[model samples]
Target chain A: MAFEIHLDNFTGPLDLLLHLIKTNEMDIYDIQMVEITEQYLTVVEQMKQLDLEIAGEFLLMAATLIHIKSRMLLPVSDEPVEEEDEDPRAELVRRLLEYQRYKQAAEALEALPQLERDVFVSRFVPTEIADSADETVSLGVFQLAEAYYRILSEVPAEVFHEVIREPLSVAQYVQLVVRQLADGQRHSFRRLVAAWPSRAELVVTFLAMLELVKMRLVEIDQVADYGDIWLKLRVAQGELAAVDLAEDGFGYG
Target chain B: MADLKRLAEAFIFAAEAPLSFERLCLLLERSRPEVRPLMQELLTEYSAGQRGFYLAEVAGGYQFRTDPDCGIWLRKLSKERPLRFSQAALETLAIIAYRQPMTRAEVEYLRGVDSGGVMKTLLEKNLLKIIGKKDVPGRPLMYGTSRQFLELFGLRSLEDLPTLKEVSALDPELAEAVPLEPESDN
Candidate 1:
């Protein structure tokens, strides 16, 4: 009770209790209830005085200790103890034992050769390519969804008014995105979505961009999180043929 | 034997990930009994050599890894982030690893704290996985250590884990818990 206790020294109440028992060098099977309970309460009180955010489980353990202490104080009959009548400290001792087992196991685990610290695996490093080769920027789907949500919020409230007579297809949006990117021009996704008059049109255009990327006709690039997504025309041989064919006679109303 | 050792070393070195004995055997067109000793010979050869790398059996497989003595230099050169685990996370993970098919409530009971946040972090890191649901009253989800756990800790399998008794010998409180005979009562 006289010693200082840092909250960080122990993971939780059980860890603190185990530390107390070990430091005292008391036999766990025959833990001195009155002494242990008093020490336990003092520690909890000290934690409270320090304004530490003691978790509810700690208080619950304190209450259980107090309950066990009070139970031990009750007068016993002159008759010999029955088999069913167990020691008050049995459950607490069992829990402490179980927790101690795991604490040691954790220490053993920590002693193992951890990856990247005690061991290093081989990492495949791609050979440097010439600047002439195309570089594809990959965006995580989560980031793509976040950018799409931002665009969705920017759509004017009035766009929801008219029930669209015809829902624009993904193919139509794909063609629309291709036309916008004609002549090897790069366009920000926001700018492309802004050009559409209705939310339906914006959504379709977004889908079209996804399709283009999937088909290798276009690539989506972002420099950082929440950054502007850039759409570039993929100039691969197969995509070149498709772009040329689309340019020949494709027109959108 | 030297030729086989060289072949095994090349296969393990060129592998993108840890290669299991079965995989190596299949690749070499040799049985387990034949390939295992050759791989072991390769393991000893690498460790005894002045090479910067060593062969390790981890994640139920064998792989070539940089020598731990060169870890600092390799980390500096590669700029690979170190995997960090808080004390609480380690405790929770240890319990799960030793006692798989355990529910969240069981973990909380053992730790005597809310392990939900730590469990979530472990799940996100792929260190812990929800194997199934416990057939209890509410049917809470059961969690187990992922294969990534073994890889991270350099353990070949659950059998490779240090026994509770062995660990307990290091701590007085833990040593006291080990019963001379198994208890039949729950």
Candidate 2:
């Protein structure tokens, strides 16, 4: 409580608590809730006085400590402590321990001979452009999902009172995607889903595209981070017909 | 064997990325068993600490890197950007690295802080990647450490990180209980 804590010293409430415990030389398992809570509140008060905006998590932990402190002040229940009546501090302690593990792990990571930071690798610049053939990397499922969500957001929200529309199947979308790439040119994933009229149809088309990628019929590539994802046919044009578009027992319903 | 060792050393030196054992085998047209000793020879020779650079095993592959002691001299030659991580970013990374394929909500819960900005920064830095979508109702994207993460940490693999006790073991009842719905996604 006597020591001044800089606002920038702690990342969060738990981080502050750990520092307090260490500075106070208190056992983590046997934390004196009353004393620790007072110190924590003092720090929080100091943070408040300085006009440093306290995150909700810090306030939440403050409230938790006060609540636990009050519980610690209550009269001892003679009835007996059982599993159902575990210590209030148990949960907090568990969380603190968990956070401590990760914090230590993070420190261990920092201490490693990190590339670019601790060790330097020779920059191997290939003078010939041909030596560095592929500038693009394969796109991940989440990247595609992010693209789909962006496209979905642009589509008008599904009207509650829906009109009867023809059912769209993944099978049909599969053929559509195949035909789009039949020319053996790179097709934009966004353009493929951009035309779908309904969310349901778009989802089906998206699933179809995913299926194609899974089957190795199509490959998704992004030239740069946050760039447009392009889908190219993996098989030759003549071999496209030999590929099957059979629905593998999944219902769109 | 001598020619193979020379080729392996040259290839690793010239390669932009860390050259994996499998790739090295393919390049040398040798079986894994045959290539094992070739890589070992290079690893041993450079590991004596006499050379300016050492063959480092990182990100599950080998790359020629200047020794840490040489970093002072190397800094003068080129001014490559040094990687820096805020405590929050490192904590977030540690949580994800330990509990991978995790949703953002889980990460936030563990850190007890809103992690959207940190997660975004990690993703932008290519330290974290979206592996897939969680199957739960909201279909939140699941995140995992990327190859660059391992490379940056000089980790041979995720298993090489310091060992941690299983989280679920901290509370038996918590482990058995159904996962509560993730806090409404930010």
Summarize candidate 2's per-residue lDDT along A150-238 as a digit string, tens digits: 99999999879878866777888888989888988999877887887678877887788888898898999888998878999999988
Q: What's the true lDDT of residue B46 in model 1?
A: 74
lDDT of 2 at B60: 85
C-alpha displacement of A176 in model 1, angstroms? 43
Best by DockQ: 1
**Residue pairs of candidate 1 with colliding backbone atoms:** none
What is the per-residue lDDT of model 1 for residues A62-106, given as tens digits with 9 covering 90 to 100? 898889889989987778877858888998888888887888788
User: Chain B alone, TM-score of each model?
Assistant: 0.80, 0.83
Note the Cα lDDT for every prediction shown: 0.78, 0.80
Lowest lDDT sum, 10 consecutive residues, model 1 chain B, at: B175-184
- Candidate 1 global Cα RMSD: 18.6
Which 10-residue span in candidate 1 chain A carries the lowest summed lDDT? A244-253
In the order shown, the candidates' DockQ scores are 0.23, 0.21
CAPRI grade, predicted model 2: incorrect
Interface RMSD of each: 9.9, 10.5
